[model samples]
Target: MTKRAKNTPRWTAGMACGLAIGIGLGIVLDNIVLGIALALCLGVALAYALPSKDTQA
Candidate 1:
Protein backbone atom coordinates (compact mmCIF):
# COMPACT_ATOMS: atom_id res chain seq x y z
CA MET A 1 0.00 0.00 0.00
CA THR A 2 1.23 3.47 -0.92
CA LYS A 3 0.72 6.41 1.42
CA ARG A 4 -0.06 9.87 0.14
CA ALA A 5 1.36 13.03 1.67
CA LYS A 6 -0.93 15.74 2.97
CA ASN A 7 -1.21 18.92 0.92
CA THR A 8 -0.48 22.23 2.59
CA PRO A 9 -2.33 25.40 1.61
CA ARG A 10 -0.37 28.06 -0.31
CA TRP A 11 -2.06 30.75 1.75
CA THR A 12 -3.01 30.19 5.39
CA ALA A 13 -6.27 31.39 6.94
CA GLY A 14 -4.47 34.03 8.99
CA MET A 15 -2.80 35.52 5.89
CA ALA A 16 -6.10 35.65 4.04
CA CYS A 17 -7.91 37.17 7.00
CA GLY A 18 -5.25 39.83 7.44
CA LEU A 19 -5.30 40.70 3.73
CA ALA A 20 -9.09 40.97 3.69
CA ILE A 21 -9.18 43.17 6.78
CA GLY A 22 -6.36 45.39 5.49
CA ILE A 23 -8.01 45.90 2.11
CA GLY A 24 -11.40 46.55 3.68
CA LEU A 25 -9.99 49.09 6.11
CA GLY A 26 -8.00 50.80 3.34
CA ILE A 27 -11.07 51.06 1.12
CA VAL A 28 -13.13 52.50 3.95
CA LEU A 29 -10.32 54.97 4.73
CA ASP A 30 -10.11 55.90 0.99
CA ASN A 31 -6.46 55.00 0.45
CA ILE A 32 -5.50 52.22 -1.96
CA VAL A 33 -1.80 52.56 -1.13
CA LEU A 34 -2.53 52.22 2.57
CA GLY A 35 -4.56 49.13 1.83
CA ILE A 36 -1.70 47.52 -0.09
CA ALA A 37 0.77 48.42 2.63
CA LEU A 38 -1.47 47.10 5.36
CA ALA A 39 -2.13 43.92 3.47
CA LEU A 40 1.58 43.28 2.95
CA CYS A 41 2.48 43.98 6.57
CA LEU A 42 -0.42 42.12 8.10
CA GLY A 43 -0.13 39.17 5.76
CA VAL A 44 3.59 38.79 6.50
CA ALA A 45 3.00 39.08 10.23
CA LEU A 46 0.14 36.62 10.27
CA ALA A 47 1.99 34.16 8.03
CA TYR A 48 5.12 34.37 10.13
CA ALA A 49 3.14 33.83 13.35
CA LEU A 50 1.91 30.46 12.14
CA PRO A 51 3.65 27.26 13.26
CA SER A 52 5.59 25.48 10.53
CA LYS A 53 5.92 21.73 10.41
CA ASP A 54 9.39 20.21 10.06
CA THR A 55 9.55 18.08 6.97
CA GLN A 56 12.67 16.24 8.12
CA ALA A 57 11.78 13.44 10.52
Candidate 2:
Protein backbone atom coordinates (compact mmCIF):
# COMPACT_ATOMS: atom_id res chain seq x y z
CA MET A 1 0.00 0.00 0.00
CA THR A 2 1.07 3.49 -0.73
CA LYS A 3 1.84 5.57 2.31
CA ARG A 4 0.92 9.20 2.58
CA ALA A 5 3.74 11.69 2.82
CA LYS A 6 4.17 12.85 6.41
CA ASN A 7 3.95 16.56 5.65
CA THR A 8 0.88 16.52 3.45
CA PRO A 9 -1.45 19.42 4.16
CA ARG A 10 -4.86 18.26 5.47
CA TRP A 11 -6.46 21.38 6.83
CA THR A 12 -8.09 22.59 3.64
CA ALA A 13 -11.05 20.25 3.74
CA GLY A 14 -11.65 20.95 7.40
CA MET A 15 -11.55 24.68 6.82
CA ALA A 16 -13.88 24.44 3.85
CA CYS A 17 -16.31 22.29 5.76
CA GLY A 18 -16.21 24.68 8.66
CA LEU A 19 -16.78 27.68 6.43
CA ALA A 20 -19.73 26.07 4.73
CA ILE A 21 -21.36 25.07 7.99
CA GLY A 22 -20.64 28.46 9.50
CA ILE A 23 -22.05 30.36 6.55
CA GLY A 24 -25.11 28.17 6.45
CA LEU A 25 -25.78 28.56 10.15
CA GLY A 26 -25.06 32.27 10.04
CA ILE A 27 -27.55 32.81 7.27
CA VAL A 28 -30.15 30.61 8.83
CA LEU A 29 -29.87 31.87 12.40
CA ASP A 30 -28.95 35.46 11.54
CA ASN A 31 -26.06 35.25 14.01
CA ILE A 32 -22.71 35.62 12.32
CA VAL A 33 -20.73 35.56 15.51
CA LEU A 34 -22.22 32.35 16.76
CA GLY A 35 -21.77 30.72 13.42
CA ILE A 36 -18.16 31.75 13.19
CA ALA A 37 -17.41 30.53 16.67
CA LEU A 38 -19.12 27.23 16.05
CA ALA A 39 -17.27 26.81 12.81
CA LEU A 40 -13.91 27.51 14.36
CA CYS A 41 -14.55 25.02 17.13
CA LEU A 42 -15.88 22.41 14.78
CA GLY A 43 -13.00 22.82 12.35
CA VAL A 44 -10.47 22.42 15.12
CA ALA A 45 -12.26 19.41 16.51
CA LEU A 46 -12.53 17.78 13.14
CA ALA A 47 -8.91 18.45 12.28
CA TYR A 48 -7.79 16.64 15.37
CA ALA A 49 -10.36 13.90 15.10
CA LEU A 50 -9.41 12.92 11.59
CA PRO A 51 -6.50 10.55 11.16
CA SER A 52 -3.77 11.06 8.63
CA LYS A 53 -3.33 8.46 5.90
CA ASP A 54 0.14 7.70 7.15
CA THR A 55 -1.32 6.10 10.25
CA GLN A 56 -3.56 3.70 8.32
CA ALA A 57 -0.74 1.27 7.84
Candidate 3:
Protein backbone atom coordinates (compact mmCIF):
# COMPACT_ATOMS: atom_id res chain seq x y z
CA MET A 1 0.00 0.00 0.00
CA THR A 2 1.14 3.50 -0.75
CA LYS A 3 0.33 6.61 1.23
CA ARG A 4 -1.12 9.45 -0.78
CA ALA A 5 0.46 12.88 -0.79
CA LYS A 6 -1.40 15.63 1.06
CA ASN A 7 -0.27 19.07 0.00
CA THR A 8 -0.15 18.06 -3.61
CA PRO A 9 -3.91 17.49 -3.69
CA ARG A 10 -4.65 20.81 -2.05
CA TRP A 11 -2.43 22.61 -4.51
CA THR A 12 -4.10 20.85 -7.38
CA ALA A 13 -7.52 21.80 -6.09
CA GLY A 14 -6.50 25.41 -5.82
CA MET A 15 -5.20 25.43 -9.37
CA ALA A 16 -8.34 23.75 -10.69
CA CYS A 17 -10.57 26.22 -8.96
CA GLY A 18 -8.57 29.11 -10.25
CA LEU A 19 -8.67 27.74 -13.77
CA ALA A 20 -12.41 27.11 -13.67
CA ILE A 21 -13.14 30.56 -12.36
CA GLY A 22 -10.80 32.20 -14.82
CA ILE A 23 -12.20 30.34 -17.78
CA GLY A 24 -15.77 30.98 -16.75
CA LEU A 25 -15.11 34.63 -16.22
CA GLY A 26 -13.33 34.89 -19.52
CA ILE A 27 -16.12 33.19 -21.37
CA VAL A 28 -18.87 35.23 -19.79
CA LEU A 29 -16.99 38.48 -20.14
CA ASP A 30 -15.80 37.65 -23.66
CA ASN A 31 -12.27 38.87 -23.00
CA ILE A 32 -9.38 36.47 -23.33
CA VAL A 33 -6.78 38.92 -22.08
CA LEU A 34 -8.76 39.91 -19.02
CA GLY A 35 -9.55 36.31 -18.24
CA ILE A 36 -5.93 35.22 -18.44
CA ALA A 37 -4.75 38.16 -16.37
CA LEU A 38 -7.39 37.62 -13.72
CA ALA A 39 -6.76 33.90 -13.65
CA LEU A 40 -3.01 34.32 -13.17
CA CYS A 41 -3.40 36.99 -10.51
CA LEU A 42 -6.00 35.05 -8.60
CA GLY A 43 -4.11 31.79 -8.91
CA VAL A 44 -0.88 33.29 -7.60
CA ALA A 45 -2.67 35.09 -4.78
CA LEU A 46 -4.50 31.97 -3.70
CA ALA A 47 -1.40 29.83 -3.86
CA TYR A 48 0.49 32.34 -1.75
CA ALA A 49 -2.32 32.58 0.79
CA LEU A 50 -2.62 28.84 1.27
CA PRO A 51 -0.35 27.08 3.72
CA SER A 52 2.45 24.93 2.34
CA LYS A 53 3.18 21.30 3.14
CA ASP A 54 6.18 22.27 5.26
CA THR A 55 4.11 24.67 7.29
CA GLN A 56 1.34 22.14 7.87
CA ALA A 57 3.61 19.48 9.13
Candidate 4:
Protein backbone atom coordinates (compact mmCIF):
# COMPACT_ATOMS: atom_id res chain seq x y z
CA MET A 1 0.00 0.00 0.00
CA THR A 2 1.09 3.53 -0.73
CA LYS A 3 1.91 5.72 2.25
CA ARG A 4 -0.33 8.70 2.78
CA ALA A 5 0.41 12.03 4.37
CA LYS A 6 -2.51 11.79 6.69
CA ASN A 7 -4.14 8.59 7.82
CA THR A 8 -7.10 10.34 9.39
CA PRO A 9 -10.16 11.63 7.56
CA ARG A 10 -10.54 15.08 6.06
CA TRP A 11 -12.58 16.42 8.91
CA THR A 12 -10.18 17.06 11.74
CA ALA A 13 -11.10 16.87 15.40
CA GLY A 14 -10.85 20.62 15.85
CA MET A 15 -13.14 21.21 12.88
CA ALA A 16 -15.69 18.78 14.23
CA CYS A 17 -15.64 20.38 17.64
CA GLY A 18 -15.83 23.83 16.16
CA LEU A 19 -18.86 22.91 14.06
CA ALA A 20 -20.61 21.30 17.03
CA ILE A 21 -19.91 24.28 19.23
CA GLY A 22 -20.80 26.58 16.39
CA ILE A 23 -24.26 25.10 16.13
CA GLY A 24 -24.82 25.57 19.83
CA LEU A 25 -23.46 29.08 19.76
CA GLY A 26 -25.52 29.90 16.70
CA ILE A 27 -28.66 28.85 18.46
CA VAL A 28 -27.73 30.74 21.60
CA LEU A 29 -26.62 33.85 19.73
CA ASP A 30 -29.48 33.57 17.21
CA ASN A 31 -27.11 34.00 14.27
CA ILE A 32 -26.79 30.68 12.54
CA VAL A 33 -25.54 32.20 9.30
CA LEU A 34 -22.75 34.09 10.97
CA GLY A 35 -22.05 31.32 13.41
CA ILE A 36 -21.59 28.67 10.73
CA ALA A 37 -19.56 30.99 8.55
CA LEU A 38 -17.30 31.90 11.38
CA ALA A 39 -17.18 28.32 12.47
CA LEU A 40 -15.82 27.27 9.08
CA CYS A 41 -13.00 29.73 9.40
CA LEU A 42 -12.39 28.82 13.01
CA GLY A 43 -12.41 25.15 12.11
CA VAL A 44 -9.81 25.53 9.40
CA ALA A 45 -7.57 27.73 11.53
CA LEU A 46 -7.95 25.55 14.54
CA ALA A 47 -7.25 22.44 12.51
CA TYR A 48 -3.89 23.89 11.56
CA ALA A 49 -3.21 25.62 14.85
CA LEU A 50 -3.95 22.58 16.96
CA PRO A 51 -1.74 19.53 16.84
CA SER A 52 -2.97 16.13 15.68
CA LYS A 53 -1.88 12.56 15.08
CA ASP A 54 -1.75 12.96 11.28
CA THR A 55 1.76 12.89 9.86
CA GLN A 56 3.56 13.51 6.56
CA ALA A 57 3.93 10.67 4.10
Candidate 5:
Protein backbone atom coordinates (compact mmCIF):
# COMPACT_ATOMS: atom_id res chain seq x y z
CA MET A 1 0.00 0.00 0.00
CA THR A 2 1.16 3.52 -0.77
CA LYS A 3 0.45 6.69 1.15
CA ARG A 4 -1.04 9.74 -0.60
CA ALA A 5 -0.01 13.33 -0.01
CA LYS A 6 -2.34 15.69 1.78
CA ASN A 7 -4.30 18.31 -0.12
CA THR A 8 -3.23 21.92 0.43
CA PRO A 9 -6.50 23.79 0.27
CA ARG A 10 -5.23 26.59 2.48
CA TRP A 11 -2.30 27.30 0.21
CA THR A 12 -4.51 27.38 -2.86
CA ALA A 13 -7.03 29.65 -1.17
CA GLY A 14 -4.28 31.99 0.03
CA MET A 15 -2.76 32.24 -3.45
CA ALA A 16 -6.13 32.92 -5.06
CA CYS A 17 -6.93 35.55 -2.49
CA GLY A 18 -3.50 37.15 -2.84
CA LEU A 19 -3.76 37.25 -6.65
CA ALA A 20 -7.23 38.75 -6.55
CA ILE A 21 -6.19 41.33 -4.02
CA GLY A 22 -3.04 42.22 -5.90
CA ILE A 23 -4.89 42.64 -9.19
CA GLY A 24 -7.65 44.60 -7.59
CA LEU A 25 -5.21 46.90 -5.86
CA GLY A 26 -3.21 47.39 -8.99
CA ILE A 27 -6.32 48.25 -11.00
CA VAL A 28 -7.51 50.62 -8.33
CA LEU A 29 -4.10 52.20 -8.04
CA ASP A 30 -3.76 52.29 -11.85
CA ASN A 31 -0.23 50.88 -11.94
CA ILE A 32 0.57 47.76 -13.95
CA VAL A 33 4.16 47.51 -12.72
CA LEU A 34 3.15 47.86 -9.12
CA GLY A 35 0.44 45.28 -9.55
CA ILE A 36 2.81 42.73 -11.05
CA ALA A 37 5.40 43.33 -8.38
CA LEU A 38 2.83 43.04 -5.65
CA ALA A 39 1.43 39.84 -7.13
CA LEU A 40 4.85 38.23 -7.40
CA CYS A 41 5.82 39.23 -3.90
CA LEU A 42 2.52 38.02 -2.53
CA GLY A 43 2.81 34.72 -4.37
CA VAL A 44 6.30 34.10 -3.03
CA ALA A 45 5.29 35.12 0.47
CA LEU A 46 2.28 32.85 0.39
CA ALA A 47 4.34 29.97 -0.91
CA TYR A 48 6.88 30.45 1.85
CA ALA A 49 4.16 30.67 4.46
CA LEU A 50 2.70 27.31 3.46
CA PRO A 51 3.59 24.42 5.73
CA SER A 52 5.83 21.64 4.46
CA LYS A 53 4.21 18.22 4.34
CA ASP A 54 7.27 16.06 3.75
CA THR A 55 7.67 13.38 6.37
CA GLN A 56 10.84 11.60 7.42
CA ALA A 57 10.75 8.12 8.83
Candidate 6:
Protein backbone atom coordinates (compact mmCIF):
# COMPACT_ATOMS: atom_id res chain seq x y z
CA MET A 1 0.00 0.00 0.00
CA THR A 2 1.05 3.55 -0.57
CA LYS A 3 2.09 5.50 2.49
CA ARG A 4 0.75 8.95 3.15
CA ALA A 5 3.24 11.78 3.20
CA LYS A 6 4.21 12.85 6.68
CA ASN A 7 3.72 16.56 6.10
CA THR A 8 0.75 16.39 3.78
CA PRO A 9 -2.77 16.73 5.17
CA ARG A 10 -5.52 14.58 3.74
CA TRP A 11 -7.64 17.48 2.59
CA THR A 12 -7.67 16.95 -1.15
CA ALA A 13 -10.35 14.30 -1.16
CA GLY A 14 -12.52 16.25 1.21
CA MET A 15 -12.08 19.43 -0.76
CA ALA A 16 -12.91 17.68 -4.01
CA CYS A 17 -16.06 16.22 -2.55
CA GLY A 18 -17.06 19.58 -1.17
CA LEU A 19 -16.47 21.22 -4.48
CA ALA A 20 -18.61 18.65 -6.20
CA ILE A 21 -21.40 19.17 -3.73
CA GLY A 22 -21.03 22.89 -4.02
CA ILE A 23 -21.32 22.72 -7.78
CA GLY A 24 -24.53 20.81 -7.51
CA LEU A 25 -25.88 23.07 -4.85
CA GLY A 26 -24.89 26.12 -6.80
CA ILE A 27 -26.65 24.84 -9.85
CA VAL A 28 -29.77 24.13 -7.87
CA LEU A 29 -29.56 27.35 -5.84
CA ASP A 30 -28.48 29.71 -8.64
CA ASN A 31 -25.19 30.61 -6.91
CA ILE A 32 -22.36 28.51 -8.25
CA VAL A 33 -19.56 30.80 -7.11
CA LEU A 34 -20.82 31.24 -3.59
CA GLY A 35 -21.69 27.58 -3.29
CA ILE A 36 -18.21 26.55 -4.37
CA ALA A 37 -16.53 28.93 -1.97
CA LEU A 38 -18.69 28.04 0.99
CA ALA A 39 -18.49 24.35 0.29
CA LEU A 40 -14.70 24.48 -0.09
CA CYS A 41 -14.29 26.21 3.26
CA LEU A 42 -16.63 23.80 5.00
CA GLY A 43 -14.95 20.83 3.39
CA VAL A 44 -11.48 21.89 4.46
CA ALA A 45 -12.75 22.57 7.92
CA LEU A 46 -14.36 19.16 8.13
CA ALA A 47 -11.21 17.54 6.82
CA TYR A 48 -9.24 19.01 9.70
CA ALA A 49 -11.96 18.33 12.20
CA LEU A 50 -12.41 14.65 11.34
CA PRO A 51 -9.97 11.90 12.25
CA SER A 52 -7.91 10.17 9.65
CA LYS A 53 -9.40 7.01 8.24
CA ASP A 54 -6.15 5.16 7.65
CA THR A 55 -3.98 4.00 10.51
CA GLN A 56 -0.32 3.14 10.38
CA ALA A 57 0.83 -0.14 11.83
Using TM-score as the measure, which candidate wins?
2
| lDDT: worst 10-residue window of model 4 | 3-12
Query: Model 3 reaches what TM-score against the true structure?
Result: 0.62
Give the distance in Å from residue 49's predicted Cα in candidate 4 to where it truly belongs. Answer: 1.4
Q: Judging by TM-score, tell me the better candidate of 1 and 5.
A: 1
Candidate whose lDDT is highest: 1
Write model 4 residue lDDT over 5-35, tens digit each, in one string: 5444345776887788777788899999978
Superposition error at 57 for model 1 (Å): 16
lDDT of 4 at 23: 76
Model 1 alpha-carbon miss at residue 37, Å: 0.5
Alpha-carbon lDDT of model 3: 0.72
lDDT of 3 by residue, 1-57 (tens): 998655433456566667778878998999988888888777766766677767585
* CA deviation > 4 Å runs, candidate 5: 1-15, 52-57
Summed over model 1, clashes come to 0
lDDT of 4 at 18: 76
The residue-by-residue lDDT of candidate 1 on 10-57, one tens digit each, is 357657977898999899999989998998788877765654564325
CA RMSD of all predictions: 7.3, 5.7, 7.6, 5.6, 6.6, 6.7
Ranking of all candidate structures by their TM-score, best first: 2, 4, 3, 1, 6, 5
C-alpha positional error of residue 28 in candidate 2 after TM-score superposition, expressed in Å = 0.6
Q: Rate the local accuracy (lDDT) of all candidates.
A: 0.75, 0.74, 0.72, 0.73, 0.70, 0.73
